[model samples]
Target: MKLIVGNKNYSSWSLRAWLALSLTGTSFEEELLPLDTPEFYERIKLLSPAGRVPVLIDGDLAVWDTLAIIEYLAERFPDAGLWPADPHARAHARSICAEFHSGFPDLRGQFPMNLRREPAPHPKGATADRDTARVREIWTTCRSRAGDGGPFLFGAFSAADCFYAPVVTRFLTYCLDMSETERAYAEAVMAHPLMQAWCADAAKETAVVDADEV
Candidate 1:
């Protein structure tokens, strides 16, 4: 299996699929392409239907889209327990992941993911406040309901957590004000072994995209 990703420092969707694959203990070759580069477009277009990163190529099957790649990995490695065991919890987890995939544009545009940057104050009227509030609501609800098993959103680092992991990075990058619950969840995500590994790699990367430098 091979996974094609974008710059570790800026590609949030790539991080999602990479994290999910790592958590599942899957061994796959990684192809890192610098975003917005001619090389990136040329390379990824050969593999992905949407010309996007985080495309998974297993044997002859190519899966694009972060959530779809995650689902494929989960089904391929059921022992990884990417989703919850309980039917209800699994359903709720899927719902949250879908919500994350479809919504949160406000948060995404205002606070792009940059793993090496320190948190800063939020800019006024920049969607930070509303985005932070919505994220806090989701975190509080998930932790209150399904966080008994562990520190993660669904307790055991399920696909839902993978979907939201980039949001955690964004919160830290922009220094978005978060509640106690949200803060704790962010800490847990940052401290996860796979996340730590990803951050380390991102920090070592020398290629920088000017657009994502902010």
Candidate 2:
């Protein structure tokens, strides 16, 4: 499999797809594109239907969207347990992932992910405040459901956590305040081996996305 992603310094969608694939323990080649360039458009147009990053190519098949890529990988590697084992828990995971996929515009617009940067003040007014509150609410609710299995949103790492991984970076990058539970969850995600690897790679990259820079 070959996964085409944007620079590790930015591109939240790329982070989601990359993390999901990394957790699967499957070997795949990675192609990094410097975002916001004509070359990016040319490369993505040739690789993905939507002209986006994080396109996963498995033999002759190409999956573009982050959610679609994860679903395909989950089905292909069932032993990875990309989703929860229980049907009910799996349903809950999917619901939250969908909500995250479509919603949280305020928070997203206010705080883009920049992994190597220190947090700085970027006032986003009432909308972002409310969105931040919603993020806390979601984290609290998920943490409450987390049993002794692991520190992830669900007991074990799943597609839901993969979907929200960028939000974790957003919170950290923006230095937004979160509750103790939320902080702990964020810490767990950051501490994951794959996440650490991603961060290390991000630190080594020289490419910059001006819009996402802090």
The top-ranked prediction according to lDDT is 2
* Worst 10-residue lDDT window, candidate 1: 122-131
lDDT tens readout by residue for model 2, 1-214? 9999998988889999998998899899999988999989988898877998889999999998888999999999999999999898888888888888888888887788888887776777798898888878878888898788899988898888888888998888788898889999999999988889998999998877888763
Off by over 4 Å in 1: 124-128
- Using TM-score as the measure, which candidate wins? 2
Q: What is the overall TM-score of model 1 with all chains considered together?
A: 0.95
Clashing pairs in 2: none
Error of model 2, residue 12, in angstroms? 0.8
Give per-residue CA lDDT, model 1, range 1-214, as digits (tens). Answer: 8889998999999999999888888788999999988998888878877998889999999999988998899899999999999898899899988888898777777678887777786574656567678778888998998747998888888888888889998888777777888899999999999999999999998787777766
Q: Quantify all predictions' global Cα lDDT against the true fold.
A: 0.86, 0.88
TM-score for each model: 0.95, 0.96
